[model samples]
Target: MSLEIRKIVRFEEETLIEGYKAAETPLRMFAVAAVVKNPWAGKYVEDLRPIVREYGPQLGELLTAKISELAGGAENIEAFGKAAVVGLDGEVEHASALIHTLHFGNHYREAVQAKSFLSFTNTRGPANAPISIPMMDKNDGGRRSHYLTLQFNINDAPCADEIVVVLGGASGGRPHHRIGDRYQELKELGHDIENPAAV
Candidate 1:
């Protein structure tokens, strides 16, 4: 089924420092959000699996494309994530139904050639509530530099029967990163470094 989108929003941010320190190049984060009518709002259904299964891929493709566009392009996006907020009348499960499945997430993951699973949030809120989209490196989920969050809200959106779905991307990891990457941690811990878990 097609996504019954009420509105779409995009957010972008660039950072060049960690506190007072400066980085040679800036790190950028981008998010694309959609406010849509929640089909199962204000009612309890014993089965939510089918509804999510049918709609997940469509929303995944649509939002992933939007985020990729906002972040420059799929090829340029080094980190990625997703999120959803169900309005007051909707169950938190409604929000999760839209984003938690591979049907939705794999589209974003494959589009950016990311090996890491998309970081995500699912919750219930009122209009204008904060939506945080946490991100991680596309190739390496545990990369400290790529762990980030893009926060935003739609002032009048996600009304009683609505849900806000978001997809996020980043051009690069945190600028001036000093902690190190996950591969290094694995090596230091004497763990198998060749096959890492998907983040």
Candidate 2:
């Protein structure tokens, strides 16, 4: 079955000043959301995999394209994440099903040529619920600077039988990132950097 998308929402923001200091360049953040009709609303499906298989890749392609465009290009996106909100009539697992699959995430990961996993959030809520997409460095999760979140809400989304799926990205880190990355802390604490399992 094809995805029945009601609307596609796009959000972008730029920060030029932080901590009373100008950033070397504007730090930009972007997100694209698709409001879709939940196929199994009001019914408990024994297996959610079928829908996940059918719709996940489609959403991955659609949102990745939109988010990449918003960030200028996939190559320009330094950080990335995703989120989903299932309507009150649906289960939280429905929200999770749409996004927590390789069929969905692989598209974004491949588009950006990323090594690290994409960050994500999923929940069940009513219209205009707060949607927070936590992000991390596309290639280096240990990088503290690229740790960020893109939060936005659709005033009339997930209307009891709908779901809002989203993808978010950033051109770079915060305007003034002073905190060093986690890897640095590991070294300072004398952790065995060579064997990752020890840490």
Q: For residues 72-185, could you state the per-residue lDDT of candidate 2 as single tens digits?
A: 789999999999999999999889999999999999999999999989999999999999999999999889999999899999998999999999999999887989888777
RMSD of 1: 2.8
Q: Locate the minimum summed-lDDT window of 10 residues in model 1.
A: 190-199
Residue pairs in candidate 2 whose N, alpha carbon or C atoms collide under 3 angstroms = none
The parts of candidate 2 lying over 4 Å away from their true place are: 196-199
Instruction: Look at candidate 1 and tell me the lDDT of residue 8.
Output: 89
**For model 2, what is the alpha-carbon lDDT of residue 58?**
94
Worst 10 residues of 2 by lDDT: 190-199
What is the Cα root-mean-square deviation between model 2 and the actual structure?
1.1
TM-score of each: 0.90, 0.96
**Cα miss at 84, model 1 (Å)?**
0.5
